[model samples]
Target: MKIPVIGRRDDTADTPDHPATDPIEELRAQLRRVCGGRLRTLDAEREHLDARRRGEAARMRRVGE
Candidate 1:
């Protein structure tokens, strides 16, 4: 008895239209996206906290006067 092939027989599977990709690069790109989002959130939070601190300081000065 003869067995039949089950998968692609030519190297055209990795054609120019669908080139192969590096796993490490893909992970790095994903990490950059996540870190960028987190950085933006942290920056916004810092700005908000700084504003609150300044307001509180101003209120304290008024009380002292």
Candidate 2:
């Protein structure tokens, strides 16, 4: 997904030696890392939940018979 250029600063009009560099890239990189970590944690939780559900279903079937 392309990160939108919403917060980018326009530094083209500045003096030759004092041109502005965008700081938004650093923030974007940090956010990306945080999102990746969250996804990993959520995936692990989903796997754990699925396993529990399967174990419960098996127990229920045994009880019903």
Candidate 3:
């Protein structure tokens, strides 16, 4: 004798009318947006510091000569 299971549905099934969105992908996209902004800010700050360092080096070289 076979017994049918009730209140059970397949979560991975997708229909043509509506597509299922993966929660993992959504979280990854949000993380990328946040990390991308932080990376850009850090890059700008590094460039500014490098420029200042170069200016100081040039001044030291002129003083030594």
Candidate 4:
């Protein structure tokens, strides 16, 4: 004997009080939050390295002259 195939009901599902979020979007938001500080630190380091390289290049040019 075959039983009735009841369709899924969203209302029946146990959802939290907040709205549901897409998994991918949730992960992207998490990455943005976690990596934001690291990205800022990396940017500061890059600027420092660039300034050091420029200073070295200027020193070399003066030495050559």
- What's the distance in Å from true for residue 27, model 3? 20
The backbone clash count of each candidate, in order, is 0, 0, 0, 0
- Model 2, 36-61: lDDT tens digits are 83433578879989999999999999
The digit string of per-residue lDDT tens for model 3 on 24-59 reads 554555566768834335788799899999999999
- Measured with C-alpha atoms, the lDDT of residue 25 in candidate 1 is 49
The sequence of per-residue lDDT tens digits that candidate 1 reaches over residues 27-55 is 55556676883433578879989999999
lDDT, model 1, position 35: 82
Task: After the best TM-score superposition of candidate 1, give how far the Cα of residue 60 lies from its true spot, in angstroms.
Answer: 0.1
The C-alpha lDDT values of all candidates are: 0.61, 0.64, 0.60, 0.61
Which stretches of model 4 miss by more than 4 angstroms? 1-40
lDDT of 2 at 9: 47
List candidate 3 stretches off by more than 4 Å.
1-40
> What residue pairs are clashing in model 1?
none
TM-score of each candidate structure, all chains considered together: 0.39, 0.39, 0.39, 0.39
RMSD, candidate 1, Å: 12.5
lDDT winner between 2 and 4, please give it. 2
